[model samples]
Target: MENKFRRIMRTEIHKGKRVHLFHDRLVTPTGKEVEWELIMHPGASAVIPIDEDGKIVMVRQYRNASDDYVLEIPAGVFDKPDEDPLVCAKRELEEEIGYTSEDVTFLYKFYSSIGICDEVIHIFVAKNLVLSEQNLDDDEFVTIERYTLDELVDMIFDGRLSDNKTISAIMTYKVSLERA
Candidate 1:
């Protein structure tokens, strides 16, 4: 009936392109105090772009952290905090995959990690994709890939896709389509 956790301290430890580190403390429901340590991320927007033919657009890139090439949806950091999620979604799509859509719809927004950090992710479905010259960041690296929705489902099941935000967006889009 009441909140169990209370934050006593939150201090920044490291800052990165997409993630930040935090040292924190909380008082538990049992009146016990504990240290909560984890990475803090500014959150991000992921785009599941579908073309006119219904093929889903994705990106393939080598993740330095994982030291492997991973398939993921187009995503990016929010340049302006006050900017709308949709705007970030569109910009990410163009910058990462070199595509844009006039029919982008917000799919879902959820927390990536909530236990120790306060990072939230906004996912979107962009339809009617059109090609444009890429505007990638100097440090950004990616290649575009298109897959049918069914194939994407298979990829998810086979573990070819491992990014949490991408997987969540694809599954949520499928569910939304079913509901409609």
Candidate 2:
């Protein structure tokens, strides 16, 4: 079978430190041509840091995009283009929550927003955590919190836990535990 779609051209519309915006022209299978705008991201990793007592570590920070303080799992963009996701997850856990883990398991990965952006977020569950000093970025202001798995699930159902990565990681971990 012939290829159904082709990218006629892709032009960079804007470039930022963390993202790039592109305008793409493509021909569809039906011979229809369209121009689409897409945002390219460097990808990121998040971790659900579970301490020895089974409480999950989270962070509260002010998000400029949302204009509110939001609760989320510790996450960050890849330190380098070829950095491993697991390494990024561990780094973020320590930076945001002041905990390092010896047992870090990949939970899942997904596109945070597929319609307009190509940002893939890898989530991991970090166990056997050891407390350490947080190494937050100079501009970062985060407050750490701990909650049981059940408490997090309740927050998700009650609309309190609205961050996508946090919600996904917690729910995924809960379901995986049930299956085990």
Candidate 3:
């Protein structure tokens, strides 16, 4: 069950607001030394907020990386290094979609990029949502959107939504619903 590679050294190449890039030297299982790039992240939490109307709350926001707007669930990185993912989820839900939930439950966790990044996304489902004021960041221009679970699945297959974490969380949420 041991699969961890031996890391000989890691040097920070650059530090950004959300991620730190490093040059890492590692020894392979075959005993060969190699250099690799790694991105260190503070991790984040996402929420699938379900309202009393049985609709899912989402947001449409512009992303600099893609130079276009993206539709995805409410999510944000931990405010503090040691902040709990659940707390982050709740805060993001209220911030991005202008709603808070009385019930939030963890669904699963996943790595964003196994090869290069140490970013882990914790997914949650929230119910009994209460309306509140949208408190987006000064730089965040977010628009609230609502959709049903079936509509999200259609968007995934139709290529309208391409955020990896969003797709993964939606699929997982659908499957969880089936099992329940």
lDDT of 3 by residue, 1-180 (tens): 356679999999999998999999998877789999999999999999998889988899999989999999999999777889999999999999998887999999999999999999999999999989889998899888889999999999999999999999999999998999
Q: Could you tell me the lDDT of residue 135 within candidate 3? A: 94
Candidate 2 C-alpha lDDT tens digits along 1-180: 466788999999999988999999999888889999999998999998888888988899999999999999899999776789999998998899888887999989999999999999999989999889899999799998889999999999999999988888888889999999
Error of 1 at 129 (Å): 2.0
Pairs of colliding residues, candidate 1: none
Residue 97, candidate 1: how far off, in angstroms? Answer: 1.5
- lDDT of candidate model 1 versus the reference: 0.84
Candidate 2 residue 26 C-alpha distance from true site, Å: 0.8
Q: Which pairs clash inside model 2?
A: none
Q: How does model 2 score by TM-score?
A: 0.96
lDDT of each: 0.84, 0.91, 0.93
TM-score of each: 0.91, 0.96, 0.96
Q: Best to worst by lDDT, what's the order?
A: 3, 2, 1
Question: Would you give me the overall lDDT of model 3?
Answer: 0.93
